[model samples]
Every structure is written in C-alpha cells, then in structure tokens.
Target: MTARLDSVEPAVRDPIRIDFEGWSIEARAGETVAATLTAHGIRGLRATRTGADRGVFCGMGVCQDCLVEVDGVPNQRACMTSIDRPLRVRRQRHGQALAAEVTALPPATAESLRTERPDVLVIGAGPGGLSAAIAARRAGAAVVVVDERRYPGGQYFKPLAVDGEDVAPPDAQHREGLALVRRALEAGVEIRTGVMVWGAFAPAEFTASDDRGAVRYLPKAAIVATGAYERGWPVPGWQLPGVMTTGAAQTLWRTARRLPGRRVLIAGNGPLNLQLAAELLAGGAEVAAVVESARPGARHLGALVAMAAAAPSLVRDGIRYHWQRMTRGVPMIDGMVVAAIERTAEGLAVTLKNASENGGHRRFEVDALCIGYGFEPSNELLRALGCRHDFDAEQNRLVTRRDGDGRTSVAGVYALGDCTAMGGARVAAADGAVAGYAAAAELGLPLAPALEREREAAKKQGDRHRRFQRALWTLYRAPPYRIEQASDDTIICRCEEVCFGDARAALAEGVIAAGPLKRATRIGMGPCQGRYCRPLLEALLAQGSDRQPDEHSGFAPRVPVKPIAIRDLASASD
Candidate 1:
C-alpha cells in the first residue's frame, strides 16, 4: 500500500481521470503522469526484464525508468509528459506493449520546423540562462532562452504546478530564482519553454525540437547552461522500486507538492540531503533518519572556517538547517554510511554502517530511501561542441574547461551553471551575468558604467562562491570507495539489466573503458543513453582495474541528447 498525506493539494480542481492499469485515478491538469500516479498510491510504473518493479527514480527525464505507455504511445516519459486531458496510461510490462498500441501525430511541415537567428542563444531558462539573457537584453541584444521543461524556473526555482493551485516556493533560494525569471521577462528576454536542444554544431548552431516540430537556432553567441543531474552510487538493492535519489524526492515535493512516502530514509553526503529532510518534514512525511557518509572531525574545521569566511550567508543557512533538524528531533547521523538495502515484505530494510565504529551495522525499516552522493555536471552538450575538458579529481568527473568569465575554449560558445562548475544556483546566476556582459561587450554592445559595475560585482560574488564550494568539497568528501559492498547479484544498469557480476566479467575480459564495456554488455546504449549508468560503470571499471578515469573518459554522447520519438524525427524530414 502507498502512503500519502492528506496535506497534499492537487494542482487542478476539476479532475481529469487517467486510467493506470485499468485503475481510474483523478489527476490534475498541470501535474505530470508520474506525479499523478504516485500521488494515487501507484509507485510501480513499470517492470524490468528481470521482473523487478521500477518507479520514478530521478523524477526527471534523465532516468527513463518512469516510461509508461501513454495513450497508446509506448516508452513515453511519465514525468515529462503532463496530464492535460483524460488519457489511458498503462504499465509497461517488461518493455512490452499491446500490438494495437499507436498514436498518430501530425506530420511536421517546413513552417513547423522553423529556424530562427538571435544575437544570443541561451540553452537553459534556469537562473543562469535567465540572468544571461537579461544582461544581454540590457546591452541591446536580442536574446532567446530555451529550456526543455514546460516552465521557466529550470530546476532551481521550479514553481509548483500553478495551473490549478497556487504553490509558492517555501524557501528564499527558490523564491529568488522565481524573481530572476520575472526580471528576465521584464527585460525583454524571449523565453521558449518545452523545447529540447538535441545537438550543437559548427558556426553556433543548435538543433532543438518540440511537439510542434524541430527548430534550428543560429546565434552570434551562445551560452550553454544545461544544468546537472543527480549522481547515482551503487548499493545493494538500490534497484528496488521505492529507492530513489534525493533530487527525485525533492521534485515530488517541490514541483509537484506531493510527498514521496510516509516514512523516508535520506542517506548520502551533502547539504542537499539536509535540505531534503527539512522539505520532507514540512510536507508531513516521516523522516526516519538522515545518514551522512562524511564524518565531521577536526580536519573539517579549517575548511569550515574558510567556508564561513568566504560565504557567511551560506554558513547562516547551514546553521538554520541544523536548527530545523534539531528542533524537529530528526536524527542527523554523521559518520554513518548506507551498506545495503534489503527488501522487506512491508517496504524496505536499510542496513547502515557506522564509519566511526569500525563498520558496525544498524538496520532501519522505512517505506522510501532517498540517496544523494553529489552532482556531476551535465556537460555532454559542451563536450559535443568540442569544448575542452579537465578532470576534476576531487569530484571524480570531467567538467568543461572555462575561463573566469564563463567563456569556453570555443570562441563563440560560453558555459555557465553546474555545467561549467558545480557551484549552486547563485554562482550559476552570477557567472551567467558575467558571461552575458562579456559576450555583449565583445559583440559591440557598449557596456554602460553601471552595467560594468554590476558585472564586476557578480564576478566577485561568483569567485567567493567558488571558494566556498572548494571548501565544502574538502569538508564533505565522499566515503572511501565501497564498491565491494555491492553483492554479485546487484544490478548496476537498470536499462540493460546488467548486474555487478556481468560488469566484473566484462572488465575481466579487458573491457577497460565505458565505451568498450558498453559495447560488450550493451549497458549505456539503453533508453537513458548512459545518463544513469555511466558514472557508476566508470567508477566500477576504475576500481576493478587500477586505471584512472582519464584513461577512459566514458562514452562520447551522440546527438538527440534526450530521446526523441521516431515519428518526430521522420516528421522533421517531411
């Protein structure tokens, strides 16, 4: 049975009935299919080939496990597909759909696949892109901002479904992001939502597509602020239906205004975990515990002091979060790491190891497990554009190389937000403003004295945030590599159903890099296109074989960054 709180409010009043496996569920208009189903006690949306149930893992389109047959269209992302009308949604049984399953979409005409040219093309509508667009417009440049989501806030200030219910952000961070959106619109930024940028090509070209058709964007200068996705770490039984990333659970609460579960266990290393705990508690969910993998010690003192000095606001925010947890009597256990998750008849049995106590074990039974290790920059689009990459050893990821002003190695291309560096939204916005200012200045838009002052201030703020982030990284370092805890039966790639044993055997057979391993086991070639499994697989390969991540820098991403329907591609040809 699914646990839902009575405190939750639907985004729409007049209900649109959606059929899920023959069960009629009342869904709101602005809510996604996943939100609608999960709210109605339907978490298991699909079954894997191994017959294990899968639910909303990432709550975004990155993890394709939420694919459901929507109105006869198989493999449609339930989270990205909003419920505008009554529809028939069915559980995709082991990737199978009925023979009669078909949805006829109108063919795309030349006019539909319209091409536009702007002075500046911003690839994301989040804080970064919005700030960039606003600055460019201030400098008398025609700016266009594109985002895949139907809304303008991106992930940081993602507003709750505002079509039916008035859901305001409960926190100041997100509130500020909403305010940025307003400023950008008032500054005459052309914000295009529901457009997916699939590829970036030579001479500043971007190929994007939406339901209407494919669109091409050519711009004098471009800013890539595509943002980042949640990083997944391997633990036994992590593939369970109820186990999801903290980002996923946060989306359920923040964007959808729905609780993930009645009893939730949040484990990982970061401020995001603490913030999630507070949100879950406010949403009336029972937070069992917040198990932090990093142990706070004397070693963290220097970094903490440095961080506090660099960003006092961040320090104050941290103290407030601590106070919230303490006042609510929520146990925030540092020096504890998740060892494994065991399936229980009721929900799940989570085994945690005390890092400070010689790996002593304790078990907690909870209905949901939300894990957040850290974030990896979603830098595929930048890499695709031939942007140089530097391996960030501390983070164990390849981030796109950028100057202080967010200019990439490419002359006309710039990068901001988490794609350039994993600084939070504020840093992204600051860097984006600077990028916009510099780009506009280079494009012959004379920077006013006041604009120059603002740009310098933003640059200074971004630098300070960068220092804070470096200190935070040192203080909250990831736990010692623990891939050994993954049992042989543990599944690594949900899309391909490849287990640890399979990956190990493939590695033993001289599959050293992500590309070879993927070709051998068909691991990253699935619907997600390596978004979910590549990081885990890369780590597994490095740990299994004594090779550095740079030795095999993962599989190179192809065009159509997100999966596009064949019909859409064919329609573009027409």
Candidate 2:
C-alpha cells in the first residue's frame, strides 16, 4: 500500500518558529530553520541596503547564499543548520556584529578556554589563501590559515604520489603550493590543515572545528579564498558508483593515484573535460569516447577564436592529438548527449542520443563515466555572513558583489579566487595577492605602488580569462533536454536516497518549498552533503511544485558549520 499523506499522521514534531523581517514561519521537528522559513513563502528573508533580496542558492553549506542571523549570530549557513531549539532569526546585510553574537554563546565547553584570537584569519589554503596568509604575516599580522583538505594545496596544487611514496614534487602545481605553505610557515603563519571554518561571525571571530576540536578564531580581518566545485548535471544512471564528476575523477587520479576505470567515457561541455581526457589517456587509461554537447557553430565563437589565437601552441597540440585519435578511429561524439546508462555484465552500456539524427541512438560499453559541466563558486561561508549575491545568468553562478580588490559587501571581510567567481588557477592566485595587499591596506598598512600595478596587471589577465570562460560556458551550457531527460525513478539526492518520486510526493503533500521537502525527505543531508546535488534537487522540486527554480525559498541555517569528527570532539576537554 502506498503511504498517503494523511494516512501517515504528522509526527508530534516540535515546532520552532522564526520571525524574520516582516515574515514568520514554523520549522517542524528535525527541520532546518532555513528550510522551514523557505517553506512559508519567505523568499526575501533578508535584503541588502540596495534592496536586493537574496536567499539560499546552493542548498549545500558551500555557497553561503542562505546565511541569516539566528539569535544574533551572523553568517550561519541555513542549509546545514537545524532548529534543534527555539532561536531568534534576523536578516543581516553587513558587518560581523550580528554574526559575532551567535559565536559568543556557542555552548561553551572546557576546551573553549584554549581558543586563541589571531590578528588575521585565513580560511582556505589554496594558492590565493596561502599567499594571503604569508603576505599578512610578513606585514606583521598574527595569521592563522585553516583548510579542510589534509594538506595545504586547495584545487590547483593537488597532492600526488610518486614511487609508492608521498613526495611533494617541485614540478607539480602543488609543489608551487608547497612553496607558499613553506613560506607562510617560515613567516609565522599558523597553519591548520584539515580544519573547516564552519562560521564567520561579527567582531572578526570565526569558528573552526577539526581534528583538534572546535576552536574560536578572533582575527581583525578574514580572507576567504575557498575556491569552487564542479557544477552538477542531471542524467540517467548518474548515481551509479562508477559515475562521477570530472573534478572528482581528477581528484581520485591526481590525489589517490587511482584509475576511475579500465575504460572511461568522458562527457559534458567544457575545456576541462578535454584537458582531463588528455590527462587520463596519458595516464594509460583507455578513453572510449569524448562526448561533447556543443554544436560547432554555437555562440561564443569569438572568445574561442581568441583563445586559439592566444594559445596557438596549446591549440595546435590539442588539435593534433585529437586528430590522431580520430584518424585511429577513436570516437569523438559532438552534438550528442548520454541518454541512459545501464550496467552490463562487462561494464557500462551508455546510450547515446545524437541531436543531428532523428531518433538516432548509439551505445558504448565502458567502465566509467566522468561528467562535469563547469565550476560554481563555493560561497556557503560568505553567504552565511549575509553577503549579497547576484545571479550571473550567463555562467549560472551566484556571484557576490565585491570591490575591485575582492572586498565583499560586508566590511572587514574579503573573498578571492574561484570562490568569488570561476576564473582559472592563475586568476585565483593573482586575485589572492591583490586581496592580501588590499586587506593589509584596510588594516592601516601603507599601500605599495607596485602592489597597485600588480593589481592592474592581474585585472587585465583576469578579464581575458573571464572572456574565455564566458565563451566556454556558452559552449558547454547544459542542453535543455537534459532536464527533460530525468527519469521519474532517478535519484537526485544520493545522500538521502531521495528519488524524483519522493520529491513529487512531498510537493503533493503541500511541501511546495525547498526547505520543508529537505526535512521531509532529507534530500540535502548526505556525506558530500548537498554540495553536488542541491541544484538538481532545486530544479526537480521547482518543477514538481510548479514553482520557478529561483522563486523557491532557501534552506535553513545551522551551526557546527562543517562536519566534525566525533573523536576530535571527544578528545577536547569539556
């Protein structure tokens, strides 16, 4: 028997009500406060002084879009947050005062006494992040750099192994990153790898809990260079174990030195896919196909041409290599999309639908599917701080408005790197340097004319890259048909194992919002959390409930911001 909405009695759930600016909502037991507010049509729970209304975009704790003040704490990600107890909620537009209030009263324990305030706190140890820390320390600021990864490098400088031993190679990008790490350490930058900054509150205090345990960092200013993640795309069999994002696959190969499969099919739109494919092929993996969704004469041709002209050698080499593969009868399917993937006895039989042919389909047997569209800014921490964002419809990114030097709307807070906007690694590092100097200047340090000159150079380089990125984005935009291709049985949220059917059922039960459905279905509460799945879930639920994707309310804000290890907390003195 199917479980009907009314047949299942509403569990005697505790009700937590939040009163926002001119709005009010009640969160059911175990529901996130953000989700609860979103369920009740509170789209603009917070508004900027410019009157720009904002809410959660990425339901994952990564994109900080759904930050709100809970009982005086500013910048808590509403997605990972739950309303376990009664609390006050407010809309914050700027400053860390409200955010600081929340952290001031974090259920204090014995370990809380050890919390040390630094002069400068840097979240994320990527090229930009590490550079910023090193620069700040050299400028006489007491600096502390925290990162979630096991090592210093963020995305650009990934750790790799050689000869059964983990060695930082001098030629590797991460080796460059290692140099920054070493410099920062030598310059007295306290580095804490494997630590995640869960919250950034007012009075320049940030909460980071990791292997050592939860610690409060009270810095004069903060630098956020958290970076970006691969955008999620919906397709059949995407939930399969062997199927992963191109970035994830690269991480596996680069970091763990593990092949995704014996035979791999790389698909999606972007230069990253091609670059990754070439890397995989060079790494001795059989690339069965490189399926791209873009048509040859699509828009953004100007930018593509410019890129080809600028990097003639790279373009020539890429063309030469791909031509060789094609001459050897290797499959390179353009204007095609993966329709379905079925696990066969041998491997994965991927059904290909070619747009050029009517009702035309082809199949390829491969062991893995490496898929990704592009990158999206990971802004959860910033959003939690109540920073404002604008939806860049072209790139499909919710970008925070920042000064020329990467200062966000919030004073004393700065954002740089791919986290601000998806420029490549070079742009990220350059932006980090600019932000570092700008932040120091903001702290009353004299500005060097050379630093301003470097900023101008960085801006020009960034502009060029951004133009190329826009063209690339247009080239690799997810086809409209991909959304229509989702099967009713397809599971969107792998963490909660929630399928399209479950999402529809939630809508039918009057959930009709992203927040409530999350609680009812646990759609965004998994290991990777909603980092990869939130956008898909949002689109699915919006369609199911007959609401525009952007119109849907945001997620609830919660604390203990990042996932903490039980052992780490247990080891901390009470």
Candidate 3:
C-alpha cells in the first residue's frame, strides 16, 4: 500500500469517514475510493471470480480490477468514484449472475433519457478531444465533448484532485492542459464529464450515461479521440494486488498526491516509464530500479541526433530524466525485463531477466511493481461504429484507418490521437484541430480565415511531432515479443484467468482466428472486454510461424462497448 506524499500540498483538509470491510478510514473530501483506500494502507479492494485478490491494476475505468461495492452498488470503479460523504464500501467478491437466456431489450422511455442535437460531437476529453471542441466551436458549430473521466485532462494531463483547484499548477504540462481546457470552455464547447459513451449507432448516433441519467447525441459530425490504454504484458503473478501499469501509479501520484508504495519497481519498454520513475523520485518514493527492455547507449547515438533535431525540448527532458536516476543512485537497469512477480509477506518479489543472450537475472522486493510495455488504441467506439482499420506491424496492433484530417471510412465519423495511431499529445492536438475544422466546414458553419492558417500550421507541427516520435522510438527500440518466453502456467487472459496452456490447447483445436478462439475458451468474455489479452491471444497465432493479421484477426466490438448498468440502458433518452 501507499501513503500520501507530505511534500505535495494538501488539496482540502475536509475529511470524511468511510467504512471499508469493518474499519472506518478517514479520507479527504472528493478523493476517489482508490486513493482513500490506498492512503489508508488498503490496496486489495476485491476478489476475482476465482478468489484471487485484485486491486487497482489499470487505475482508469478500463481494467475493472478496482471494482468495489459502493453503498451496495456492485462493480463501481474505485479510481473513478469519489467520496463526497460518509459511505460504506466493501471488497467485491463476485457480481450478481445473469439469467441463462437472452430476453427482449429493456424499454428506455423518452422521458428518462436526455437527448440533444449538435453540429459536432467529440468523444473523449483528452488533448485531441478538447482541441477539436475548441476549434469546432471557434468555427461557429455547436460542440459537445463527452468523457468517462471526472475531469477534462486525459492520462497525459492528469487533473488536480477534484477539490485541488486551489493548488498551484505543478508543471508546464499541467498548465498547458489547464489552458487548453479553459480555451475550450471559453469557446463554448459543452464538455460533459463523468459520462460514458456506451454505444454508437449508424450515421453518428451515440448514447451516453452518467449517474444522473443517459444522453443520446445526434450530430452532423462526430470526432472520436478516445485515446489509448497501456498494454499490460502477462507474466507469472502479474495479477497480484500491488502490480499495475506505470501510468496507473503515475496517475495516483499526479492527481491524488499518493505514491503506489514507498518502495516501487518499474518495468517497461517506453519513455513513459522513465518519466514515471522521475516523477516518483521527485514525489518521495524509493525507486528500487527501472527495468527497461531497450538498450539506448552508443548504439543509439545516431538516432539521438535526429530526435534532438526534431524535438529538442523532448530530447532534453529525456536526458534530464535519465540523469535524475543517476544522481539519485537509482539503478537504471537497461536491457532487462520483469520476468515475474510473486507476493511476499511484506510486499512483492520481482524477477528481472536480461534481454540479451547472456540471460542474467536480478530480483527486488518492493511494495509495488509497475509494468508498462506499450499501448493499444482504445477503439471500441470506432469499431462499434464500423470504422475501417488496418493492422500496424511495427506496433503489433490494429490501428483505426483515418485520412489526413482524421476522416474514417464512415462518411460522418472521424478518429485521431492514440486511438487512430500512436502519436503523442501534440501530434493528436494538431490532428484534432484539422479534423474539427474539416467537420465544421462540412456542416456549412461560418469558417474563420484564421482557422485555415492555424490548420496549416497544425499540419506542419504534426509532421514534426511524428518525426520526433519515430526518432524517439528508434532510440528506445524494443525487442520483438515472444510468448514462448513466458511460463505455460502464466495467466494470459487476466480477467478470465485463462492460462497460456489453455490458449495453446485451443490453438491445437485448429482455431486460428480471434472469434472461434474466444468461444473455445472464455478468454475475451471478461469485464475488460479482452483489452489486456486479445492482442496476446492473436499473437499466439504467430507464436513460431510468422503469421499476419487477416481481416478477421481482431475481435468485433458489440454494443454496450464498455460494460454499463442495465438500469442506465433502460433509462436513456434523446
């Protein structure tokens, strides 16, 4: 478990008592259930169907690991739900079982659902969505942006605590995100937070719901900037209570001013890991080590030149982060990976394996282990809308297909940001501005002359960001993933707890595609909707043989793309 950092100023001192299990814990007003529990030295919030202890693994609402029964409502995300008053929370063991047979759709009366018509609707409240809304509204189009999070900034710009508005801006990124949010609000962009866009119908019709009620949006144009979630690689005991993605830990510190643990070990294959390590160090955590799979030294000097040339500030930040570890005497274990994690009496024992042929190993005992391999686009909405996509071999994932201005195969639909491709925040913002202008133009909204110039400028800026990302990836090159490296007993499908052996057996049955394999084993039927395992399941197809992704390689997204309450479904209005 973790504790609040004393260095970080308190957001608000108003404390509320929440009864978890039988213990009454004091939590700051407006703090999430996850943060409150963590601050009070409680991490394990639930038990999987198989009775494995689970906690906040993804930190976001995506993973569903932090499901806690809040005031009797089961399956509430601890990280997303705040405690504004005294409450009784419980560690959820299992959900209520559903009936065996399907029945008719629930009746959703018009009076219960709130509906609206807008010139443009933007999904997600990340940089891309906010930029799109600002641009579209500036171009004289009525805009509405919906996000599942409680705040405007996405993962990149994790907002201050809900009651932390009075706190000083922590960094330039925070200031920039706040400025962008302000700009969007000033432009009259209607942003609805804490609302989940659960389903999308044809011709850009969308349905969303929050705690109060559901909303249906009919728009002339809709921009999808749902962004992406980090890819969690499966290893032995990876589903332990204290293990989570690096971003999850970072979000806890950034927004709630709490460390995952006093001692933390981070293992990953991207610059984000380094950024997290640096942030944790600054936030008063004992970073045992940073296990990076990439070797970036003399072998990558050539790539560094191009990176510095393209984005000098970002390169400088990387160098600073690299040095911070050195001066602090934190071991920056290069060319190594986290092979496995096992729970110990105190915390966790992590095994680090070398990426080279020498096969050296190291181990560390820490309170938390953070794993962040890479990312996969959160494309459920895009897929449910029937937008076209293509498999990107470099990233080893299916990326949504979009044109220069983020237009998709569907006439009125658009996608951008990490959802369409793995471009960083600036790249996504630039792309979003261009898409917003394009959508406004199509809607016959009054276009400003300044917008055309800004759009062109954004295009050029995006080109630079892309070049920098390419160079950055080159500098931090990762070895190809081989599922054979993992133990046969390692759980592949985290939600279902399906093992690698189980998948191999299904493969032996001649099930090569995603759909049949999903049926053969209940792999993709879990709450995460296979976000953690589907790619790895697909990777099983090319385990030894170099198989490629066919048109049917990926799983199809159905309605209620994300799990939503049936009550919410029955009460939606437009």
Taking the candidates one at a time, how many backbone clashes does each contain?
0, 22, 3
Order of quality (lDDT): 3, 1, 2
Top model number, lDDT? 3
Report the poorest 10 consecutive residues by lDDT, candidate 2.
Answer: 1-10
- How far residue 183's Cα lies from its native spot in candidate 2, in Å, is 5.2
Runs in model 3 with CA error above 4 Å? 1-13, 95-106, 109-113, 162-169, 356-358, 544-546, 572-574
lDDT of each: 0.80, 0.64, 0.83
Cα shift from native, residue 206, model 1 (Å): 1.6
1-574 per-residue lDDT for model 1 (tens digits) = 0101221222345768988878888876777898888777677888778777888888778888888888877888888887778999998777464353223444554345568989999998888888888898999999888888777777777666634444444467556756777787778778877888887776577888876767788889999999888877677787777888898888888777777788999998889898889888887889999999887679789999999999988888888878887888999888887778888888899998875444678899998899887787788788888888877777777878788788899888999998766888879988999999988887899999999999999999888988998898788885654666667777778788888888889888887777778888888877888876787787787774567665137878688777876566546554
Model 3 agreement with the true structure over 1-574: per-residue lDDT tens digits? 0111221122555768999988998876756899888767687888887888899889988988899888977889999997779989999877566443312346685445677889899998899988888888999999988888877878889876644544334677777877788788777888777889888888688888876767788889999999899888788999999999998998888777778998999999989999999989987889999999999888788788988888899989998998998889998888888878899999999988877543688989999999898898888888888888788899777788888888999988988899888988989998999899989988888677888899889889899999989988998887866677767899988888899999899898898778888999898899899888888887887776878774357677877888887667665421
Measured over all alpha carbons after superposition, the RMSD of each candidate to the real structure, in angstroms, is 4.7, 15.9, 4.2
Candidate 3 displacement at residue 235 in angstroms: 0.8
Candidate 2 residue-pair clash tally: 22
Q: Each candidate's TM vs. the true structure?
A: 0.92, 0.73, 0.94
